[model samples]
Target: MKLETEIKKPSHQSEPDYVTGKKDEIKSYGFECTDCGADINIDFQRQIKYNWTGNTDLISESERTELKKYYGIGLSEKSHDGGYPVFDKIVCKTCGEEYLTYCGVREFSNSAYSIHVQEIQKIK
Candidate 1:
C-alpha cells in the first residue's frame, strides 16, 4: 500500500471544540521514507505561541473592560488558541532512519484554521 493509505488516523490526537476547554489536539499522518522509499507514520503536537485572540461572548463585561484598558483592545484576555504542530521524531520502519518534523498552520480563528508541514529533518 501507499504511504497515505497505510496510516488511517492520527496515532495521537486531541478533541477540539470552542465551548469546552479540551480544544487542543495533536494531528498525525504518514510520509514516504526518504532513504528506502517505504511508508512511514508520523505524529505531531500543536503549539500556540504569543498571539491571543479572545472570545468576547464567553467573558463578563467587567473582564472585557479590564482587558480593553490593559491592551487597548476589546479581547477576552486570552492567548490565541489552536496553533501549529511539531513532530518530535519519526523512525522509518523500513530503514531505521529517524527524522524531526516541523509543521504549522497559516491562521487560527473561531471558524477555521490551516495546517502545513513546514520542515522535515533527518536525525539518524
Candidate 2:
C-alpha cells in the first residue's frame, strides 16, 4: 500500500515522553491518521535492536539525561551492540496502512547517541 498523503511527517515533539515524566508512560499510543483523519491506536512491543559505537562515558551529562529519557536505559548501560528496542510499525486499523517510527543508537564523532522519531516510512 502507498503512504496516506494527509499526515505529514512528525517531528521530535511527537516522540514518546516517559523517562522524564512523573506518571508512568504507556507504551501504547493512540493518534489520528495523518493521511485519512481516522483514529488509530497502536500497541508497541520492542522490535528493533540498536548497537552503538562507544559507551556512555563519551557523552556529556546533559546528553546522557536526554538519552535516558528517550531510550529507557542510560547510556552507561547500553551494550556495545544492544541498544534499545522500539516500536517498528504502527498499523492504522481504519486504513490498514503501516507507518514506521523508531529510536536507535548512532555513531557520531566517535560517540553513540540516541535519536528519537528517526523516520516515518510507509509500508505496503
Candidate 3:
C-alpha cells in the first residue's frame, strides 16, 4: 500500500450551532524495509524493551546535544521512554536484515500527535 499521511474526521458540533466545526486532521507514518521492500509496522508501546544504543556517530554534535537535553541525560545513558533521536536497531522479518531505525513522536498544541520516521538505514 502507498504511504498515507493524513486522515480527516468530522468534528462534533453542539446543538443550535450554525457554524460547522473544523475537521480534525490526524497524521501517521508508515515504514518499509529498505532492502526487501517489505512493509514494517512498529508498535512503539509493545516493543519498549528493544536494545537502544547511543550511536553518536550517526548524528551530528548539535543533534546529540539536543537529544541529551531532551532526555535529561547523556546519550550513553539508557532511556525507557522512546523520545526523539531514536537509535534502536530493528530487524526486518522479510529480509532478515537489521536496520538502524530512527523515529519519534511530535505533539502539537491542539493535542494531535504525529509519528515521524526520520531514517532507516540498513546495517552492513
Candidate 4:
C-alpha cells in the first residue's frame, strides 16, 4: 500500500474545477523495456490524468527517445493538495520505487538564485 503524509497548506486555494471534472490529460513519452525487447516505442498522449497529469508534449519524440536512452525520468509530480504546486514525487518505474516529499516547489522557487536558468534547465 502507498503511504502518504497529511499535507497541510498555508492558504486555501479552491480545487480547480476541470471541465471534465475527472482525471484527464495523460501525456507520457518514454520507453517500455522489459526482459525481452531493448526499448519499446511508447509515445502516446491524452488530455487525462490517469498516468500523467501536468506532463505535456513539450519535447519531441526523437528527443524523448534519446532521453529515455540516457537520463530517463526517475519520478513525476502533480498537485496533491490545494496549497501550491510542488515536485513531491520520485518514482522509479524500473524497480517500482517511489519517493515523496523530496522537493517543495514553493521553497525552491523562493530560494533559486538562477530562476531563469532553472526554468530553462527543468523544462525541455
Q: Write the per-residue lDDT of candidate 2 for residues 11-41, one digit (tens) a residue.
A: 4344332222226645544567766778765
Any idea what lDDT model 3 has? 0.41
TM-score of 1: 0.39
Model 3 clash count equals: 0
Cα-lDDT of candidate 1:
0.40
Per-residue lDDT over 11-102 for candidate 1, one digit per residue giving the tens place of the 0 to 100 score: 12333322112355445556777678897754422322211322122334454354335323323332122343322346788788766543
Candidate 2, residue 95: Cα displacement in angstroms equals 1.4
Per-residue lDDT value at 101 in model 3:
47
Q: 63-91 in candidate 3: lDDT tens per residue?
A: 54554465455544533233333444456
- TM-scores for all predictions: 0.39, 0.39, 0.39, 0.19
Encode model 4's per-residue lDDT on 11-123: one tens digit a residue.
22433322222356222322323223233222221223112222224334454334333322334432232112222232334554333221112222332211000010111
Q: Looking at model 4, which ten-residue stretch has the lowest summed lDDT?
A: 113-122
Score residue 114 of candidate 3 by CA lDDT: 37
> Weakest 10 consecutive residues, lDDT, candidate 3?
10-19
Model 4 per-residue lDDT at 101: 23
